[model samples]
Target: MIYLVEHFYSIQGEGRYIGTPSLFFRFGACNLKCEGFACSEVAPDGTVVVGCDTVYAVNKEHFSSQWGKITKARELLNILELYELPEKSVDIVLTGGEPLLYAQDEIFVEFLQVLHQRGHRICFETNATIAVNFFKYEIYKECIFALSVKLSNSNEPYKKRVRGEVINSIATNAKDAYFKFSVDAESINLGLEDEIFDITSHAPSADVFCMPVGGDKKTVEANTPMLVEFCKAKGYNFSDRLHIRIWDANKGV
Candidate 1:
């Protein structure tokens, strides 16, 4: 069964595909806590519920009851039917909580095959830690991988967050791929350059993109200029978190 946190049709808000109208499939479960950036709210019962923007997708225990356990491809496809596409072709993005955690999954792969056959352009927003066994699974080759390699700002240990083999696999096998790093003043002050040096040392040719880390328009405004200059000076691409600017990090894009 494929575990899904939520799915929606919204414009691409980050990376090279920014501003493109697309469908998003957010899979549940993640390998890293990245607890430093957790957000919270008070429920009707006055319970303090805390999590990241994708907290429901990350901490399964907190949100497990809400997850959609898709046992069949048609059940998943029925959700896509709501989009009412221009044709069978449309841009589709798979995100997470680390959607690639199911890279080796059988039912998920079957669903991917059907999607590919229908001409949907698939994109995976991944943390670049889980290695794709490309030799066994050919569906991965049909998708574009937008790798967001974690940095010290996430507060995750280096070994758990960055996996060289996975980055290498995505770079070597995906239909196309690029690197996107979440940037903030804190990340820059904390030797983000050093982290980049380590990643690029291994995968030097990958196109690098930097997105300011923020939850709301005000915060995005505060962080954008620094990230822009940082990207300009370093010759990397600057990405805008358009979704936050448009909706202030609300649920369902």
Candidate 2:
């Protein structure tokens, strides 16, 4: 079963393809709880939930009512129809909580195969911890991957966050892939360069893009300067959290 949290049509807000028109399919469930990033929200029962910006999608116990259990590829295709998106013009981004967690699921694979058959460019926004067998799921070979791997700033242990073999597998098998790290002033001061370098060593050929760590406009603004300079010094691409800047933490773009 595919547990979908939300779906939206919006411009790509960060990474290499920022500002591109895209349809997002945000799934629930994740391998890591990045509490260190510190974005929080209140649950329906008034519980103060905390984690990454998309905590609603991550804390399933708090937000399970919001997740849609999808059992068929046709349901997703029907959702796509509502948008009436131009034929193959908009990109398809499968995000999370950790979308790749369903890589081997029959329905998830069927959805990807259907989209691939229709000539859409599919991109998975993943943490790079879950590795897929591209040999078995050949359709994934033609997809793009935006590897948003968690860093030390996420409060996840190094071993849990950094899986060298998995990173290499995605980078080598995907048609196109890149690394995107979320950084804040504190993390940068704590020697983030070395951390990023260590992670990138696993995929030397993939390009790196870094964005400031923030779930709101003010936070993003406060961290952007340091991140920009850090990127300048390290020759990494600087990406902005454009959605937050434009909508100020509004959900669903």
Candidate 3:
């Protein structure tokens, strides 16, 4: 079964395709909590939850009420129709707590199959932990991947967050792919360069883009100067969390 946390039509807010008019499908659940990033929310039950900025999407126990359960590819297709988007012109971004968690689901694969058949460009904004079997799911070969792989800053262990073999596979097999790391001032001071270099080494052909880690506009602002300089020093591209910048702490944007 596939679960969709939310769907919206918005401009691509980060990475290679930033600002492009796009349709977003945010899936629920993820393998990593990324508590190190330190974004938190209090649930109705008075439990404090922590993780990456999209904690609501990750903590299903608290936010499942907002997620739409999907049983068929047609249902998603119908959701797309409501937007009345131009034929195959808008970029389709598959994002999540971790969208590829559903990689093997029959319905998930069917949705990708139909999207590809219709000529829409698909991009997966993933943490790069879950590697799709591109040989079996050949349709993924036609899509781009925004590899938002986690760093030590995420508080996830190296073995859990960084997968060298999986990184290489996606870079080598995907139609196009790139690395996008979420960094902060502290992580930058803590030798993030070495860690980032080690991961990117696994995918030599992919370009790297770094964006400040933040859940709100203020935090993002605080981290930006350092990250911009960091990117400049490393000759990497700098991406902004434009969605957060524009719609701070708001859902369904």
Candidate 1: 10-residue stretch with minimal lDDT: 38-47
Error of 2 at 24 (Å): 0.4
Q: lDDT per prediction?
A: 0.82, 0.92, 0.90
Best by TM-score: 2
Give candidate 1's error at residue 37 in angstroms.
2.4
The C-alpha RMSD of each candidate to the native structure, in angstroms, is 1.7, 0.8, 1.1
Per-residue lDDT tens digits of candidate 3, residues 128-197? 9888899999998999999988999888999999999999999999999999999999888899989998
**Best-fitting candidate, measured by lDDT?**
2
Q: Name the runs in model 2 displaced over 4 angstroms.
A: none
Q: Judged by TM-score relative to the true structure, which candidate is superior, 2 or 3?
A: 2
Compared with the true structure, the alpha-carbon lDDT of candidate 1 equals 0.82
TM per candidate:
0.94, 0.98, 0.97
Report the Cα lDDT for residue 178, model 3: 99
Residue 165, model 3: Cα distance from true site in angstroms = 0.6
Residue ranges of candidate 1 with Cα displaced over 4 Å:
41-51
In model 3, where do residues sit more than 4 Å from their true spots?
none
